[model samples]
Target: MSVAELRPNMDFWQERVDMAAAFRWTERLNMHEGVANHFSLAVNDDGTQFLMNPNQMHFRRIKASDLLFLDANNPKTLEGPDAPDPTAWGLHGSIHRRCPHARCVMHVHSTHATVLAALADSTLPPIDQNTATFYNRYVVDNQFGGLAFEEEGERCASMMSDPKVKTMIMGNHGVLVIGSSVADTFNRLYYFERAAETYIRALQTGQPLRVLSDEIAEKTAQELEDYPEQDVRHLNELKAILDEEGSNYAS
Candidate 1:
């Protein structure tokens, strides 16, 4: 039968559609590594049960029906036929298990973000409005363990304990962002890369950087946080464009 007929009562269909759209758009923006990055969203209370991308799948080809349902509390998750990537399971799984506030988590090794991560300091300063949006709202993880196995995942998860910190600059690695929903997290991830790009380009200019004041940066951050429905609208508009192009992301 057809794909829809195979799964008649797909749970969290809208969430899955939004996530698939995010994946497609991220790939279009060249923010995804070669079948490496992963995105996840919590579906149950306490955030232990979640949905994640299938193992080694390219973001551009992901569909709503392809997400993997998993539980952080389940020991046999990795033994199943539909098991996720080890590092995805380790990092996203650990975050969901420990940080209930992080309902949605996205991890990617996008170029500019990874470049910032490779720096000794690995901090995103408030240089412009986009950069200011993340002022005092992110954590820097200097500890770069080899691959994100269970131990490394747990260690990284611990750094996200603070609800105020929505982004993590994974030193010598990549970037991880968490939010209450797919749109929120994806929007944060998108802007973060843009901000990193601006900062990196500024450094390349070798000119004096005009940094925003702490007061103004904090104010701008608060304003953006209070700005209503920007994240939701952002994703919705993207989905609209995808629909116009007859993309199969939602299928």
Candidate 2:
């Protein structure tokens, strides 16, 4: 559809479509494990309520309008046919309630992230540009006292307060990334998983891993200020690949 011809509500529908697309894309990329992963996006401008995948649907089966609209302030989820998973409630609900700046939150337990999380030292070494994308903008939450619940989620909110840190390594759990949009979150999540995989594999090689100096790593990360436009191109390319394979993603 032509940009000029798009409706005023296009952004709303597009957000839903893209949110659904992120879930399906994660599954296709092997980034989801059953119904474990949770992805959320704040709705409207004030960022009170958010969009999240329904309680039990596998990532592949998610549809645009099928998402649940949840209120962050209300402790009890609105009476609905599709309640969100309890863990999702614990993780995303706390974020939405506590982190107003976190408009979009993504949590996943993909192979690489889980692998890195399992490490005694789950810190990502600045090995390359991709690994350097986070630089000081990532946190290692070493204290994983079971799933995020009650005080635990509140603990997460405190630990995840830095605006610069787009991603967090929930030690012994998985990865969490926040963005202004699903495209941004997914892009960061994708690169983070790949970067972690690269970091771990390089360590396995047993060669002295070349680590970038903090100054250079910070510089490289600053260069990623261009990533908003860069990420649009990247996400479009990935979307095209998925479209070629199947168009069921946003339906």
Candidate 3:
């Protein structure tokens, strides 16, 4: 589904809850980097307004109501009392503004993905079905400017604006997964790191890799793309765990 499709009688509050759960689960999975890294979901029908975590808040402790609402086009948002991390606003704001297809975005520096990013050939080799999911579906931001201020964010946004790009492997940095929904984006984020881990582990072995042929890899990727709505179910299961464990994320 598309961002426009996500609008109309939508429950923005429910979106907050879902996004907060994503944060908590990311923390549980040890994917968070202190108070850094950010995720955002567009709240507006046009995808210009979004919800982001406030600066310096640990993901595990974030609650649904703790999310900050800001407009992508509003320059004065940074001056507000609940201003988001500059890098968060820069990266997420630009993407939500320029790439409507990217209604939900997950940016992280998970261990394996970051390890892969640091390598000279950072492209994810299609050695298995998991790695094939991103066969031709990702972009590589080879230039790693210091922090992602608005300028760097704009550059990143432009890279993702291309309709074909669903994942971005930032050289010397990490990964960014974009999708139409938080569930889909989160699932992709989880699997992309899994794929990276597989690649890194294979590299650690002294033997050469038996990489998949381009024909087989592309076929597997398309099949993965055609797979049904498991992401929504995945998010539902996650929320159920939070409900049973505690409801801190729901607020």
- Candidate with best TM-score: 1
Residue-level lDDT tens digits of model 1 in 1-251: 55456457998888899999999999999999989999999999999999999999999999999999999999999998889999999999999999999999999999999999999988888999999999999999998998998899999999999999999999999999999999999999999999999999999999999999999999999999999999999999999999899998988
- The digit string of per-residue lDDT tens for model 2 on 5-106 reads 444434467777788778878998899989877899998666668999888789988877778888877766735557788778778888877777889999
Reference-based TM-score, model 1: 0.97
Count of clashing residue pairs in every prediction: 0, 1, 0
Lowest summed lDDT over 10 consecutive residues: which window, candidate 3?
1-10
lDDT score, candidate 2, position 66 = 79
Error of 3 at 135 (Å): 0.6
Q: Which segments of candidate 2 are over 4 A away from where they belong? A: 1-11
lDDT of 3 at 250: 78
Model 1, residue 242: what's the lDDT? Answer: 100
Those runs of model 1 whose alpha carbons end farther than 4 Å from true positions after fitting are: 1-7
Candidate 3: Cα lDDT at 52: 86
A best-first ranking of the candidates according to their lDDT comes to 1, 3, 2
Give the lDDT of residue 3 in candidate 3.
31
What lDDT tens digits, residue by residue, belong to model 3 across residues 1-251?
54335444335778888999999999999999999989999988878998888899999999878888889999898998888999999899999999998999899999999998899889998999899999999988899997999999998999987777899999999999999899989999999999999999998997899999999999999898888987899999999999899777977
TM-score of candidate 3 relative to the true fold: 0.94
